[model samples]
Target: MPSEPAPPSSSLAERVARLEARQEIEELKYRYLRACDHKDPEAFRACFIREGADIDYGELGTFATVDDLVTLFERIALARHNEGHLVLDMHHGVHPEITFLSSTEATGRWTLRFRQLNLAEETERVLCGDYDDRYVVEDGAWRLAKHHFRSLWSLTRPLPKGYVVDEGAHL
Candidate 1:
């Protein structure tokens, strides 16, 4: 048999640190998605840096600050119709490709599977997109420094008459 292959060049500590950082970053992305689905503006805002973040969501608009994005998020996501939420959203982020540029800086790309219900318009939309993100350590935590979303495709159609959605005790 051939001689044993050489081990990785990085030390155990360095490898562990990198793994932990990746886990934190992935959790951050999931939290952001959960906030969107739950309509929690505070949680959503917490995902990004406090200021001066490059955010682009295509037709939804772009912002240089988290405040601007939160303002718009509140206007649309918090709207109500017929004593129920005006819009319901679900976000599934998958196939993350993360790379480290430094111990405290990294980049990630994710595929997004999105679904939305518009109560006011009686329409449903299914969309697929890609997210390009930059992450940095701020105040000892990973935060989104740059976020860009490009929609690959979307399908929107009117909901059938007499159809209803029951939240069933979950918001």
Candidate 2:
């Protein structure tokens, strides 16, 4: 029987392609944050694996798949709809320090800030946090594999009397 053929080594062109793609992923990460602040699911969805991904929220532990994340968001969005608690409601920001782990993987730490009004609690909150994320290149796209969110600080207080929520405050 003939011996099996040897596998081809990674060519220079292949390496260059991988590097270029990784850089593109980094750019996508920044776009993702802005898109999220805009509350555009179409944009947000582009940043994640959308299936078989894991998310860890520290004390809340980890969710095994992207579907879980979607489910939670659905609940939040639905509740917010009734109370007009839409995010992108206030100034929200994410600053990323993304690093390449390999041609197909990377990790990043992000600083995040957002405001939320919890009508059920009759309180408004400003949350500041850091997110540690793992990214994977799958099928030529970068997707979040494990996302860990930790709140570093939070300020909560009552909404001022006669203070009306404005959806365009940040826009």
Candidate 3:
């Protein structure tokens, strides 16, 4: 017999602030993926807080500070680089669900499609996982407060010899 009242509209300023926060977080995620793929430890480290950061890459070991991750990345990625072996990787993130818990805190979930080609091992690995992340404002900028990834499935295969992908092939 009666209808509920419609919800009030958010103010223009509030809406803009929310959008800005989301955009900042999206950029942070993008930078992280790019840094990882390019093996740029400095860029990767910049995406997170320097102190009191929790990074659990799931079997890669957890680190309390961003410096720890950078150290590991350099040890692993640099060693491969120095040996003249290629380690190409790509990280595609989709289906982002970011929630702003407060002006200074937020949480996010994302689906990650990761591909890696290890020339030294002559193998390629494809992985799919979800990233659960936390963000906080430190020094008036949004930074990754905590980051974790849980793999859903993965595949490792040897690349066929003399295999070449034709760039001209199209639908």
Q: What C-alpha lDDT values do all the predictions have?
A: 0.90, 0.66, 0.81
What's the best-to-worst order under lDDT?
1, 3, 2
Q: With candidate 2 superimposed using the best TM-score fit, by how many Å does residue 78's alpha carbon deviate from the native?
A: 3.4
Candidate 3 TM-score, C-alpha based:
0.86
- Please give the ranking of all candidate structures by TM-score, highest first, separated by commas: 1, 3, 2
List clashing residue pairs in candidate 2. none
lDDT of 1 by residue, 4-109 (tens): 2224797877777888888999999999999999999999999998887999999899996899999999999999866678899999999898888888998999
Superior by lDDT: candidate 1 or candidate 2: 1
Superpose all Cα atoms of candidate 2 onto the true structure and report the RMSD in Å to 1 decimal: 8.3
Top model by lDDT, which number? Answer: 1
Per-candidate TM vs. native? 0.93, 0.70, 0.86
lDDT, residue 16, candidate 2: 63
Tell me the lDDT of candidate 2. Answer: 0.66
lDDT of 2 at 60: 51
- Which digits, one per residue and each the tens of the lDDT, describe model 3 over residues 110-150? 99999977776878999999999999998888999999999
